[model samples]
Target: MRGKHAPRSTRWPIIILVIIAVILAPIIYGASSRNRTTKNQTTVSKKTSHSSISSSSSVKSSSTSSLSQSSSSSDVKLKSAWNTTKNKQLSAFMSQWQTEMNQTYSGTYDGQKPDYYGISFPTALENGRLSGHIKFDNQNTTVEWSPNANSSAKNQVLAVAVGQTSSNGYNRILYLFIAQEKQPKVYVSQTTNGEDLYFTETQNTALKDGFSQIYNSN
Candidate 1:
């Protein structure tokens, strides 16, 4: 029986070692688990922060794009307005023109001749619609005057200065709105007095405004 039993002191040391292992195992496991949890939390926090930054960047980019678009649209509108106001050929001729409107037309198209109209107070003499004669005795009747309100091409016109005709009318009162090519040439109906027929400064300004009104009305 004595041989089978180990010493008490040696058994005590073995027991103590087992107790120490038991206590340290739980503490080490707990520390490792806490470290793993802390690491997982740090990873999640980094991901969330990155996502927030991306979202903020996207919103800023969209705002910048919208502002650029608005600025671009505004520039286009301003350029369009400039193009409309800087009429080159039209403006150049208008600056030198000085003819005052001596006549106003009723613009009432005749029933008989659809193309014909009446003048309100024509200084020139002619047998025309204002006289209540709708019927034309001649098929090749004269226009009696140019720059009538009925012409659609009023904006692209310039009158020539021919002298008064022997009939006391604008020599070639029968002219039509002059084409761009014929703008510089002398008109057949130009005043006979050899005086220049360009509109006066005041007359030119009025005519420009009148044509603008007509354009708007149309």
Candidate 2:
């Protein structure tokens, strides 16, 4: 009866099942919590990435706008460099001979007070010359100048000092032009001054002598 009256093995199986269930419960819960934390981290990462991309896009847009404004300001400077009449006329004149029109130009010049702007013109110079005059505040001084080359019998630049002016301390209005003779172009300058100053004659004569040295017809 001692051996035969022993409890059935079925009770042992049931006890084993209960013990296994108790041991697995905490492990399953911990695994589920870890999975939920991982999911939350992934969501946060996605949000951060999206925000970074959006911020970068905004920065690029702002930079482009700033560049555009800078270019526009440069354009304003170039327009103001010459007188209104001469500016319009020269712009029209250059347009007629140009093949390529795209240019990015910005620089400084001597005459511009505080700051100067460097402007670029069209490169193609055909069989013709472009010219214009810039007048200063003084009535007697008129700068008659052309930067383009004259298509004459000699095929050379015709920059000359016609009126009275001096290169000394006095402020002379320069008639500026670009001479398109060959690959590299020359900048032609002419000075003008009132009759009262005898120094004006000296300046004019000196400039004329210098011009003759460079562009002598003979």
User: Pick by TM-score: which candidate is best?
Assistant: 2
Model 1 regions lying over 4 Å from their true place? 1-12, 81-218
Kindly list the per-residue Cα lDDT of model 2 for residues 83-108, writing each as its tens digit: 33433343443333121322211111
Model 1: per-residue lDDT, tens digit, 1-218? Answer: 46867655678889999999999999999999999999999999999999999999999999999999999997764343212233333333333332233432121111111121122223232334332221122222223323322233322222312212244443333222232221211122222222212221222345445434322331
TM-score of 1: 0.36
Going through the candidates in order, what is the number of backbone clashes in each?
15, 6
State how far residue 55 of model 2 sits from its true place (Å): 1.1
In order, the Cα lDDT scores of the candidates are 0.38, 0.38
TM-scores across all candidates? 0.36, 0.37
Residue 10 of model 1: what lDDT? Answer: 77
RMSD of 1: 13.7
Worst 10 residues of 1 by lDDT: 107-116
| lDDT of residue 167 for candidate 2 | 37
